[model samples]
Target: MKVLALLLASLAAVSAQTEPWCRCAAFVTYEHSEIMVFEAPEVTIDSCTDDAKQCKNSCTKELNDFSNNGNLWLVQENGLTVGQNICTYMADHFFYFIHNHRVYGYFEVCGGAWEYTGVASQQLLCCNGGKHEHCISK
Candidate 1:
């Protein structure tokens, strides 16, 4: 009985660590009556921040490559991950959320045809679990 109890407790701890922090879905709306929605795996805030950092680094590299190739349209204005906020660019869309803030998730409006550019000429939308607002959940 003691061994069984210990085993059960160990399993519970492991499962808890592996569990997702929240279930999130992002939506991108276009001006031409088009919308795209993406479902993200349940991810914790820490993981989200890590993802954003990775994205920033990758995007910076891409920008460098473009500049080296004589493409002047794309430039790294400022670091993507900075201050208390982090923005993660995931292919077609990007998400930004404040670190340590009570935000459920972040969102950005992607314009034009889907592109993998670091930043797009688009609008910004934020969801921080404000009054009369809802956010992502587990």
Candidate 2:
């Protein structure tokens, strides 16, 4: 019994360490008529932020007549696993506004949701989680 208990504890610790921080899904709506969805793997908040910025930039360039009022939904599955089973997590929805080919304004999924209006500029850099920040576009 002692050996079995030790093995179980070790497995638990390893599982906790290997687990991801969160999982998210993104959506884009064009002219309130077309909608596109993207599901991403489990990642950190900083990664998500970078992803959000990139998506907004790409969409603006791709769709010249894009509307500012669009929706983005993200689900935080804390201490959970994402695999073939996609029904285990609950998604928290957020809204975004695009103006002048830039991403501005967003809603956060925390403490009953909050809205913030701001402008963001993107710099192309190779960000490896604080390891390096080199220009990737130039």
Q: If scored against the real structure, what TM-score would every candidate get?
A: 0.20, 0.21
Best by TM-score: 2
For model 2, residues 1-112, the per-residue Cα lDDT tens digits are 9999999999988676532233333322246542222343333333333344434343343322222232111112443211101222112122222222222222232112
Tens digit of lDDT per residue, candidate 1, span 1-138? 999999999998867764223333333444464233233333343343234444334433433342332222223355222111113332224433322222112221121122232432122333332211122443
- Give candidate 1 regions above 4 Å deviation: 1-27, 30-34, 37-51, 59-118, 121-138
- Name the top lDDT candidate: 1
Off by over 4 Å in 2: 2-16, 27-36, 40-42, 45-138
Prediction 2 global C-alpha lDDT = 0.30
